[model samples]
Target: MKVFIPLLLGSFIFIGGLKEGFVFLFSLLFLLSLVAMIIGLIRPSLLKFSNRISAMKVLFPVFLASFLIVLITTDPVEEPRTDQETVQEDAVEQKETEETENAEEQSEEQKNKNEDENAAESKNKDNREEIHNEEKENANEESDSSSVNKQEEKQQNNTENKNDSKTLDEKESDPSNDESTNESTDSESDKRPSNETKGTTATVTRIVDGDTIGINLNGTIESVRLLLVDTPETVHPSLPVQAFGPEASSFAKKTLSGKKVQVEYDGPKRDKYGRLLAYLWVDGKNFNEMLLREGLARLAYVYDPPYTHMSSFTKAQSEAVNAKRGIWSIEGYVQSDGFNAVESETETKQSNNSSTASTETKTSGSSAYNGPYNPQGKDRNCGDFDRQKNAQAFFEAAGGPEQDPHRLDRDGDGAVCESLS
Candidate 1:
């Protein structure tokens, strides 16, 4: 019974170890126990003691209980997979890997396209800015060009106006037409003085001298000699520059140059030299009287009768004479005929004495009835007399043919004051 019990436990243990996938050591232990049980059954005397009734009976039940406990606690093994199912799973994994690769490629391509678009947009923006700046620069350049053109046109117009004014002056002063007009006017003025007191407006274009200016009369530039006033000979052809001449010219330039004035006509319209004879009024004040009042001019050229402003001009001259200003400052400088070039008595004596013998010889034949003639008095010139016959009479009285002290006959023709009307 003991041997049978041990043998049954070993068989159940070995089968349970293999079926439950237990360790090889448990199978080896089951085999060893089975061998031992067989040996014990076969040789009972080897296991028993001298006094033992049966040792197997005591150990066999314990071994059977241990094997039963091990068998009850073990789990069953799982079944293995088939080859076809494994192949299908590998195919599904490969397809998923390919889809993931395609998605990544699409994302990379979209990123590159976005970068290209952004680059193109930035380039376009830069181009637009450059074009806008260029346009602005061009506009500024055009504006500058337009301004330059306008300035040039304005300058050109001013130049043209000046040239036109000059041309008109030249045409009016032409010698061809002036001689006939002056001759006719001189004859008429000598017969009867014109009472034309009507005034006209004119602009002074240039200061010709202290008592003369070039005026723009209705777009025509005419040389205007201030009526009833004579400044020092600054621009005379045959005379030297007299004292205070430049001062008088400077005063005229300051007072009348570039100024609009009123031109009041007197007895004559023009002089023998074709210069217009008019009284200049500046700001409602008589410029001619102003010159005399300032001592820049002397009241002279009273050849014609009935001068309108003669009284006023004489008053202005009296003021300057009383003040002893300008020409009046010099003693014996202002005279009846004209200004004396020499102020020294010695020079005057030398001049008078040098021609004395010749003067006596020439005056012996002249029948002088006497129209204010003084041989040994103040110097006389052609400007002192009103007519040519009067000057001739004075020249004859002063022995002009042999010795001309006053130098009335500039051409040495023995015809005194031929320039006079």
Candidate 2:
């Protein structure tokens, strides 16, 4: 009965171990119990030790309890998965991985595309700005060209008119008859004021500045300040030579010096300075309008309203402002009262510094006067220097022929103080 009981318990444990994948100790215990059962059944003398002990009497019952315990504690083996279910799970995981990879690639491509679009937009913006600047420059050039053509045409017409007037005068002065006609004309002319005569032909004796001139009107020399125009002060009593001042003076000298101009008086004939206020027409072109169109002067001294040619003068100034010519080129330079000379002086100083630096290396060994020759300094005269060479050096240094700030080169010739020893 002991052997049978132990054998039955061992079989149960071995089956439980195999089914549940138990530890090695359980397998070993099952093998040992089977051997002991077989030995006791084959040899009766081997069962003598178990019979001598009272504990051995309950060994069958213990074996029965052990078999029941093993049966209760053991877990059932799970069924294996089918091939189709395993393949389906693998396919699902692969699909999810592919979707994630595709999403990442798409995000990277979108980022790159946005960056390229932004770069292209920036490039297009720069190209547009460049084109706009080019258009502005072309428009300014065209305006300047048009003004030059008009001036040329007016000059040609003036020449023809002058020739016709000369022919008429020659025919009238034939010294044959018309004494009574001449006496009637003289009596009619005596009724008008000589100094305030309108449309008087005068020879420009000297160009005082941009907007002022000395004219010989009927054998009388008079200082005429152009009406309705004010240029930058090159020779103001209180103001230092402002920016574009020298250029304005140079333009006047080049165009109106020694030329015949028709002086037309307005309501006010004289200014506070006792200078004649008139509109000078040079070669049939309004000289005041020319100065304003070139940006060399501003429309000013308009104390009297409803003046003739006011609309045309405003249009000329508008063109200059649009083109940013001369005084208009400097921001905030032209003010309501006058020009702001501070910025002009600063620019002049910077320009002079650069010019000096460039010429320093070239004039290092030259015999030219190395002394200070400030063009913007106090007015100098031919008597300021002792010798002709010294005067010439100073004049050239002070921009002599182009800019005679000191009036050293009186005749517009390159030489200065020519009579000096």
Candidate 3:
């Protein structure tokens, strides 16, 4: 019977795909059965059939609990990235690189062409000057001969041609004279690749976060990650929302949402995530620098080459940090490793007290959402019955389910203000 039982169980395990969880559960059961059988043999009087039944009743519940825990904690299998998607991404990157290189080559070729034209014009002018001088010498030495007169006429003709050539060159070089045509040319010059393409203007379709935004690039909508700035994480899948993240998101939405912006490429056109990397210019100001100056963002060190505004951005961040603005006001808000806001014991106690008051208000059937939600300030929390913007604010201030007995953080990644997030 024992031999047949194991054989039957082995067949069942194989049919179950022999998964690790199944194998572990089967092994535990098999060992327990063996131990029970041995104990019964060694002390038959102590472990009777009735005793065995009682023991199984206890063991079954423990076994079921263990199985449940394993099911809940085990990581699911991840799907593999498709080959087709990888190839497509690679092709796009290659095409963008080629276009940038072509622009640079074209600019260089244009410069060389202008230089050659100038050299040719100057050489022809020099030759005309030498001929005019020779004609003058002939006029001074000759006694009003017809050949001398013809030479003077030739000199006058050369002077007229030189003057006309100089005038045409000046007109071609000077664009300031024709205001209407200049305005039109200036508008198109944004996209034209000269020394560098002027910042291309685009309409902001959406603000993804404080440091990320969506802009309509020509006809296509592309994500643009801001250069030299990193705000707190409010929408990260793996990590919980950091303190002041919502404030940053809110600021970005208010300032940049649905606005037209100029996107200027600094280093590479696209980042590794296939998002366009650019500096955003709004109302003739650098938005990234403004965020730093306002103490809304920290300086990120993930810099690539040709970081033109790095020094200025670094200086702005220094000023913001020294001023103790926004997130910097919170204790232990480190710059290098994101916002690690460390609350002191007193602060924690105060926060807990506030949370308690808010909780009591909710439990006592008093409405916490009774007042107007003014989202203008930087450091607004959930306990402030003055304003409750959304569930995210409630969730963050409530400190989630563990801290927030109110269950405000539904998904529990510590994020609130869903509209801004």
Task: Report the number of the highest-TM-score candidate.
Answer: 2
My TM-score estimates for the predictions, one after another, are: 0.36, 0.38, 0.37
Once model 2 is optimally superposed onto the true structure by TM-score, how far is the C-alpha of residue 150 displaced, in angstroms?
Answer: 41
Per-residue lDDT tens digits of candidate 1, residues 1-421? 9999667666765785554434333444556555556656677567663322354564455446546645664455676768987788898899899999999999999999999999999999999999999999999999998787566555544543232111112424565434454444443322322224436788888775688777889987687879878787554423545666767888999999889888888775775445688888776677887888898777676655578765555556656777888777778677654677864565445434534544454457355636776653566777788899888877766555544445465444579777789
Residue-pair clashes per candidate: 0, 0, 2
For model 3, what is the C-alpha lDDT against the true structure?
0.60
Residue pairs in steric clash, candidate 2?
Answer: none
RMSD of candidate 1 to the true fold?
25.7
Q: Which candidate is the best by lDDT?
A: 2
lDDT of each: 0.66, 0.67, 0.60
Could you tell me the TM-score of candidate 2? 0.38
Off by over 4 Å in 1: 1-198, 343-421
Write the residue-wise lDDT of candidate 2 on 357-379 in tens digits. 43442244234556554444677
Candidate 3 ranges with C-alpha deviation above 4 Å: 1-198, 341-421
Q: 382 in model 3: Cα distance from truth in Å? A: 35
How far out, in Å, is residue 349 in model 3? 11
Arrange candidates, best TM-score first.
2, 3, 1
Task: Say which prediction, candidate 2 or candidate 3, comes out ahead on TM-score.
Answer: 2
Supply the TM-score for candidate 1: 0.36
